[model samples]
Target: MRLLPAALSAAVLGAVLATGACGAASADPRVDAPVPAAQVAPAAQAAPAAPAAAQEVLPQRQAAAPPRPVSSGGASRAPVSDPGMDAAADGLRPFLLTPAEIGPEFTAGEEPRPDPATPAPCGGPGVVAQFPFAVRVGAAAESANGLVQETVSVYGDEAGAAEAYRASVAGMSCSEGRVDGRPAVIAPAEDLRADLGHDEATGWRIGGAGFDVVMISVREGEVVMNFTVLAAEDGLPALPDPLTVAKAGTQKLLG
Candidate 1:
């Protein structure tokens, strides 16, 4: 079966509301490549709709969009029961963060296939995901920050998972790299520390001229998960704590 690489087409470009112009009540920033608005999911998790008068006073932010679901062979966001695969071995869907876990400001992001120039955290000629599914969420595609991206690759054995984690850490130590199409510097994220409830974990800070990203990865048995949180043109306030978020995502994936 063909493995569907990470592609968050749903809200990849969701526009961050132009807060200052919109007079946003919350002290937060907005999105980068805004999605067409037509494809955004409902705002059930977003803050309650402001009173008409309140909205009138502050510029309205773009509606929050959740990340699109991913699965092997480009399957639907929702995980399905595959007769060939046991639920215990279903690695794609359960490895990702749930909508409720991500909160409101974020929307689904459309992710392009990895650019060859961009180095994978786990170095290799290329990535190998036996069964891969990914979710990328952010305020905007281009200029906003707090873009959270998670990709899970499940191998059939623990050794493969361990090697992937080791290789990714080695690859992630580079001094220079690219992120979200921008030139960036890669370094240890020493300040953003956390125990992460387990082992085989590491993190990096990718700094670009227009954006910054915090990337963390952890391995559980046959599964290795990577999390990247971006701070784009807007900022990071709109999103939740990166370490905290990663920890929660890890639990779900391992749970």
Candidate 2:
């Protein structure tokens, strides 16, 4: 929900980005896309070969597009372009988890750019409110673990970051709040907590009728990072270890 405040990642890159993988799990974690997995082998009778004229040469050369930061579910297209967001980004870039840190298979999104959609935040006026500026960077990945997503917000100082962190954790009590942009209910997941000696660590299992999201957030200095694993309700399995996501994120930041 937007109540997530400054922590949104490409709207769902923060939440919805997990949709594709989670949808697959809840629907059928089967290999539906790999043709060989679902399709039967060719029939006993072979088709006649086409005339030689039917064959055509394929293009030998083509213009190459710029490489993307990520290839799959992560939208993380936005970068910190504005001075405010850039300031926050500059202060925390070293601490950001690289795509490799996010996952061995994870690809990055576009290079840093502005995210105007994320404006002033309110925890009642939240995390972003405590700082002159804040930075947000996010990426997504699909692993055997589940649909994993990460969104981080960097404030100006530890005091502001801590205040924002507290406000965000407290926001969990709201019976209804916007997620991405839609309204959803909030609930505690009652799962593992991060314990890497960060000044603060907490988690939440939150979602509504159609989906469930489990997230763990830890603050190291001015940086507050959250790693979330989620699924849709249809065939939703018992939520996986939010600790896995949390620790991965913490290690990325710490290392």
Using TM-score as the measure, the top candidate is 1
Q: How big is the RMSD of model 1?
A: 14.3
Q: How would you encode candidate 1's per-residue C-alpha lDDT over 1-255 as one tens digit per residue?
A: 111112212132122221112221232111111001111122111221111212222112344321111111111121234443323334344445654567664454443232222224222322323223222211112213234555554545667556655555555555543332223345543422346755566665543333334556666666555565554323444456657776877666565
Off by over 4 Å in 1: 1-91, 111-118, 121-124, 129-146, 180-182, 189-194
TM-score of 1: 0.53
Stretches of candidate 2 exceeding 4 Å from the true structure: 1-126, 129-132, 143-146, 189-196, 234-240
Q: Candidate 2 at residue 136, lDDT?
A: 62
Candidate 1 has its poorest 10 consecutive residues by lDDT at 31-40
| Per-residue error (Å), model 2, residue 110 | 7.1
- Each model's lDDT comes to 0.38, 0.39
Choose the strongest candidate by lDDT: 2
The predictions' CA RMSDs to the true structure, in order, are: 14.3, 17.1
